[model samples]
Target: MKSNTPRMPGRPKRQDQDMPVQETVLFTASRLFMELGYEAVSLQQIAKACGVTKASIYYYFDGKPQLFTASVSAVLERARTSTSQILVQPLPLRERLIKVSEAKLARSHGDFETILREARSSLSQKQLDEITSKEEMIHDCLAEHLIKAMDAGEIRRTDPLLTAHAFSAVLMLGIREIAKGTPADKLARDIVDLFWDGLSIR
Candidate 1:
């Protein structure tokens, strides 16, 4: 989930000394973690991928668990912030929802979920709780947006909370598969069709 690019406000400023290097390492490590589960990857592998010595990586992170946690947290927090901003934008409900969806999927950045999955066993209870809280907030944010759309009759009158979670689940599933491919435009079109028209033989 660690992103190479910054996209939100009020984030901790990165220093010139070693932060960028750490970020670069973390970003690359996140992609590897996503494609290969945590249990399957080694610290030496990550260090090699970063083109740095294992000792150099140790300068920034204590170990794999800490590095993995920090990397995923950075990515997830950014994604949440970006998604929140898009979902709460002052636009038409349908447009806002679509924008929010696009932003969320884009924020996935092709490897966020994979890193998240691989980092599961490395997190402490506190880290797990923090992650869960952020995820729940994201879901709630989407539900609130959906409620607005429902009130405006911009979409069907489904239960906002349920609909939001359902939409997110479906979207993420598609995203996971599409991430391995290079067909973004088609993925977007199919998502829109599924959301607007559903799979009914009308």
Candidate 2:
């Protein structure tokens, strides 16, 4: 006669067990790439950070170029989603622009200039084009919203594409202010006030 017995749970599952290895690698690689720049980071470093092997990384990505592109793409996708949400708010155009600027500044942590410069050497032309295309999509999204605001007479009529580019540049500059310990709310207001003073239709 056999006695019925409940099987004990094996080792407790790790909190990250539910996450796929590829996703883990992507996230870890993105942080490393941002912190260390593209050329300075390596698959071995990422693998160790993710608690996996270099071969495991290769299983998910072809090489460093592919991983770097994927990591940057992940960041852009997140920024796109956040920008979309901010743009869709029912706030006034100026307020929406401020919020968007704040969001962009909040997300700008990496040494982007280094990443972009280094990526050109490591990434293929197609990969470089893809990155540029993603950037253009963000610009185009802003431009589309600017065009709508102009049509509504909420702001002065201007070249939406050029205006969008200018707005993005100004917001990028705000990152320096953030580094200087200026509050994001204050920076946002200052940026919007300065931009509106010039762009607003009296």
**Candidate 1's error at 171, in angstroms?**
1.3
Give the per-residue lDDT of model 1 (tens digit) for 13-126: 444554466777788777666557677778899888866677767777778888767766666676667777877778865555566666655544444456566677778887
Off by over 4 Å in 1: 1-19, 103-119, 179-182, 197-202
Q: TM-scores of the models, in the given order?
A: 0.68, 0.86
Q: What lDDT does model 2 reach?
A: 0.81
lDDT of 2 by residue, 71-92 (tens): 8888877777788889989999
Q: Name the candidate that leads on lDDT.
A: 2
Q: After superposition, how far is residue 137 of candidate 2 from its true place, in Å?
A: 1.1
Model 2 regions more than 4 Å off? 1-16
